[model samples]
Target chain A: DAGVTQSPTHLIKTRGQQVTLRCSPKSGHDTVSWYQQALGQGPQFIFQYYEEEERQRGNFPDRFSGHQFPNYSSELNVNALLLGDSALYLCASSKLGLAGTSEQYFGPGTRLTVT
Target chain B: DQQVKQNSPSLSVQEGRISILNCDYTNSMFDYFLWYKKYPAEGPTFLISISSIKDKNEDGRFTVFLNKSAKHLSLHIVPSQPGDSAVYFCAALAPTLYNFNKFYFGSGTKLNVKP
Candidate 1:
């Protein structure tokens, strides 16, 4: 079984530009969560998608958005990105059952460099 | 403020020695805790986790001890191997009605197991 997979291992964008990264969750997973990790920092929760709807979000601004498809894949779109937006974008997959275990598997992450 | 924090930025230990990494959280609502290890250019790999109700959880080579009153947790790696040399992050999980995967991560501690 394949684990979580992300595309565009490395990306470069100019200030004010937009970028969209893709993620495919592991087999048999349903929920997807996006996170951002800056230099020398742990991953911060950006938002979470479940059943094709955004169920929860973190302290990030409106510029950060995400979508989940029926296939359990996800897309993270960042608009009008700033230099500070440059970070490693991580996608995590988990299963939420009646009694959730709250365990997650993460993708390799996409390194975004906004200049 | 950071809900989870790992004070030590880096730790160096000789091979076969035990490695103890500590983490603290300010949020009392965190009922579940986890530890993740990340190698360069890769996403975090889930190591082990413990629920707030349990004081300790042990796996083959990794053990996690949680002190609920102190709001502190620690990961102990016995007879560490060189492959364990990576950045270890401490994460806390608090489920809400909106999102069941509310994970808060610490800055991380880089472990260097010297041979």
Candidate 2:
């Protein structure tokens, strides 16, 4: 089965511009989560979506927002992007309830470059 | 503040030898720890994990050890293979009312196994 999938493998935007990234959950998975991985650093949780609603969010500011569709796919939108926003935006999917026990499979990630 | 830390940025070991990766966290509330491996241009893949209730968890050639008291964890790869060369990331989950699966990640360690 196709694991988590993300669109726009690469992107470039200028400061104050906005960018939208997409993610498709793995087969048989209902939960979708987004993360941002800076160069040479581990990923930082952006937010999680379940049942079409945001279930959790990280310390990121309001500029970062996300949505989950009925089909369990997700979109991460970053408004007013800054130079620091240039990084790999990763999307991970896993089943709920199993939570921390089960592993979250990640997508290839969207490489965002902010100028 | 960075809650999770992996001081080692990279490591090199000869094939068939033991490779150890270490991680430390400052958050006492972390309930689960996990390790993920990533190759260039790919998302991080789950390796192994250990819950706070357990001291160790093993799966085939990978093992994860958790020390709650010391707030330390480590991943040990036995008989390291050349294929194991990649970036290893350590992630910790801290219990929270809002985000149950929220994870704090450390700077990944790049491991190179030589033949």
Question: Candidate 1: where is the Cα deviation over 4 Å?
Answer: A98-102
Model 2 Cα interface RMS deviation (Å): 2.0
- Model 1 docking category: medium
Candidate 2 per-residue C-alpha lDDT over A1-115 given as tens digits, one digit per residue, 9 for 90 to 100: 9898999999989999999999998998888989999998889999999899888889899999998898999999999999999999999998886557555889999999999
Write the residue-wise lDDT of candidate 2 on B24-44 in tens digits.
999998898989899999998
- Expressed as tens digits, the lDDT of each residue in B1-115 for candidate 1 is 7999999999999999999999999999998898999999888988888989899999999999999999999999998999999999999988678445768999999999999
Shift of residue A72 alpha carbon in model 1, Å = 1.4
Q: Candidate 1's chain A scores what TM-score?
A: 0.95
Give the distance in Å from residue B44's predicted Cα in candidate 1 to where it truly belongs. 0.6
How high is the DockQ of candidate 1?
0.58
Cα displacement (Å) at residue B64, model 2: 1.5
